[model samples]
Target: MYEHLEYYGVSKKVIEAMNKIDRKLFVPPEYQDSAYVDTPLPIGYGQTISAPHMVGLMCEYLELREGNKVLEVGTGSGYNAAVMSLLVGPTGKIYTVEVVKPLYDRAKKIIQQLGLENVEVFLSDGKFGLEEFAPYDKITVTCYAKEIPPALIEQLSDGGILLIPVGDEYVQILKRIRKHGTKIAEESLGHVRFVPMV
Candidate 1:
C-alpha cells in the first residue's frame, strides 16, 4: 500500500504516517480483504472510509507538522483521523467530530484500542466546527458540503489551512482554503465525490 501510494506521488511523510496505521483495522470484517486496494469502503451509516490516495493527498496538502493541532470534520471510520494523528505526532492533537452516534462510538472505540492518545472523537454535527477547540492550525472536512461552512473559517487560526469539498451531493470540488489575518484565499484541488455533509 505504501508503494502504491508512493507511485501516485504521495509524499514520503504522509506515506510513513499511513504505514503506522493499519487500514484493515479501520474497516469492517467483510471489507478486510479489500482494505489495501486504495478504494473507499463502506463503514455503515451510509458513510465510507476515504480511499487511501485521497487521504494521502489531503495530508500532503495540509502540510501537517508535529505539534500542530488539527480539526477533522467527519470522523467516518476514523481512518483519516488516525493517519493525521501520526503526522501531528504525540505533541499534536486531532479533534474529530461525527454526527452519527454509531460511527462516533465505533471510531472512538477503535481510536482508544489503538492507544492514540492525541486523538479525541466527539459526537456532534461537524458543520458547527467544534468551537470549544477553535483556532485549529489545520482543518479537514471529509464529507462534502454545499458551501464552506462559516463556522469552520471562523475557527481557523490565522495562517491556517482548510481542505473541504463543496458542491452538490453527486460531486464536489475539493478546495484548499487558507486564512491569512482577515483575508481568505481559496484554490481548487479538483473534483471529488464524497458523502454529503448533513
Candidate 2:
C-alpha cells in the first residue's frame, strides 16, 4: 500500500504516517479485504471513508509539521484522522468533527482504542468548523461542499492552509486555500467525487 501511494507522489512523510495506521481497522468487517485498495468504502450512514490517495494528497498538500494543529471537518471512519494523528505527532493536536452520531461515536472509540492521544473527535455539524478550537494551523474537509464554508475560513490561522472539495454532489474540484494575514489564495488540486457535506 505504501508503494502504491508513493508511486502516486505521496510524500515520504505522509506515506510513513499511512503505514502506521491499519486501514483494515477503519473498514467495516465485510470490506476488510479491500481496505488498502485506495478506494472509498461505505462506512454506513451514507458516508464513505476517503480513498487512500486522496488522504495522502491532502496531508501532503497541507504540509503538516510535527507540532501543527489540524482541524478535520469530516470524521467519516476515522481513517484519515488516524493518518493525520501520526503526521502531527505527539506534540500536535487534531480536532475532527462529524455530523452523524454513529460515525462520530465509532470514530471516537476507534481512535481511543488505537491510543492516538492527540486526536479528539467531536459530534457536530462540520460546516460550523468547531469554533472553540479556532485558529487551526491546517484544516481539511473530507466531504464536498457547495462552497467553501465561511466559518472554516474564519477559523484558519494566519499563514494556514485548508484543503477541501467544492462543487455539486456528483463531482467537485479539490481546492487548496492558503491564508496569509488578510489575503487568501486558492488553487485547484484536480477533480474528485465525494459524498455531500450535508
Candidate 3:
C-alpha cells in the first residue's frame, strides 16, 4: 500500500493512514484481494470505491490534522472516511453521509466493524452539508455538484477548506474553495469525473 501511496504522491499523513488501515476490510469480501491494487472496484449500488490515487490526491490536498473535525460527503463504501478517521485520530470526529440507504447501511456497518470511535455515518443528502454539526474544519464532497451549495459554505468554519468536483454530469472540475472571513476564493485543481451529488 505504501508503494501505491508513493506512486500516487500521497503525503506523510495519507501514507500513514493507508498503511495502517487494511483496504481489504473496506472492500466487499468477494473483492478483498483487489483492495490494495491502486484501482477502484465496484461495490454494488452503482458506486465504485474512489481510486487509491484519487483518495491520496484529495487527502494530500485537505492537509488534515490530528484533531480536526471533518465532514465527508458521499461516503460510498466508507473507505475515504476510514482514511480520514485514521488521519484525524481518536480525538477528532468525522461525520459522513451517503444518500442511498443500502450504501449508507453498508458504510455504517463497515465503520463499526473497523471500530472507528471517531467516525459517524448518516443517511442524508450531501448537498445539505450536515449542518447539525456546523463549522467543520474541513469538508470533502466526493460527489459532483453543480456549484458549492450555500449550506456547505455556511457550514464551513473560518479559514476552512472545502473541496468538491463541480460541473455538469459528464465533465467536471475538481475545485478547492477556501473561506476567508466573508470572502471565498476558488481555484480549479484539475478536471475529474465523480458521481453526481444526490
Question: What local distance difference test score does each model get?
Answer: 0.94, 0.93, 0.88
**Model 2 stretches astray by more than 4 angstroms:** none
Worst 10 residues of 1 by lDDT: 1-10
lDDT per residue, candidate 2, 64-107, as tens digits? 99999999999999999999999889999999999999889999
Model 3 scores worst on lDDT over the 10 consecutive residues at 1-10
Residue 106 of model 1 has an lDDT of: 94
Score every model by TM-score. 0.98, 0.97, 0.94
Error at 168, model 3, angstroms: 2.3
TM-score-sorted candidate list, best first: 1, 2, 3
Q: List the residue pairs that clash in candidate 2.
A: none
Error of 1 at 9 (Å): 2.3
What lDDT is reached at residue 139 by model 3?
96
Give the clash count for model 3. 0
Model 3 bad stretches (over 4 Å): none
lDDT of 3: 0.88
